[model samples]
Target: MWTAVLLACVGCYLLKLAGMSVPARVLDHPLVERVADLIPVALLAALVAVQVFAAGPGLTVDARAAGLAFAFVALLLRAPFLVVVIGAAAVAAGLRLL
Candidate 1:
């Protein structure tokens, strides 16, 4: 397991290094810039969806779902980031405590 972990880490580092070594002209392309700008948002949404809905390789809805809903509403309302996070945590904790 340790060997596998070390290999994976090395592979990830190499991949990152390869990306960084790509030619500046390639990275400066307009399409690449647009996609790069959007990648973080897409990744974050995917991560949130997985965390809020996945359970042991299956889908489960619970306090996290509710909290995410509240967070979504807060975002739509233009609440501050800190407020959105705190509100979501409060909602999740309140639901779990019930």
Candidate 2:
């Protein structure tokens, strides 16, 4: 067990060294930037959809769906984060329980 832990630590350190030592030129490509730009939008779309409609394997639409949709629109309009999360949660909980 001790040997395994030692090997794991060394392996992780080497991996980190390799990553930090990579030349800046490789990361300066426009393709890398373009992909980075698209990643956030794609991730956000996935997260929002999952939060709104996901209850299990198959998609669902319930109180959470209505609340999340409203929150999305509110966020697009520059509403504060706390306001959106709380408002959406409130609406969802209310619809679900009351």
**Candidate 1, residue 97: how far the Cα is off, in Å:** 1.9
Among these predicted structures, which one has the highest TM-score?
Answer: 1
lDDT per residue, candidate 2, 19-51, as tens digits? 789788876889887887899999998998887
RMSD of 1: 1.6
Task: Name the lDDT of candidate 2.
Answer: 0.88
Worst 10 residues of 1 by lDDT: 49-58
Q: What is the per-residue lDDT of model 1 for residues 65-92, given as tens digits with 9 covering 90 to 100? A: 9999999999999999999999999999
Q: Would you estimate the TM-scores of all the predictions?
A: 0.87, 0.66
Which regions of candidate 2 deviate over 4 angstroms? 1-23
Among these predictions, the greatest lDDT belongs to 1
Residue pairs with backbone overlap in model 2: none
Q: Which stretches of candidate 1 lie over 4 Å from their true place?
A: none
Model 1 vs. true fold: TM = 0.87
Instruction: Give the C-alpha miss distance for residue 13 in model 2, angstroms.
Output: 9.0
lDDT of 1: 0.99
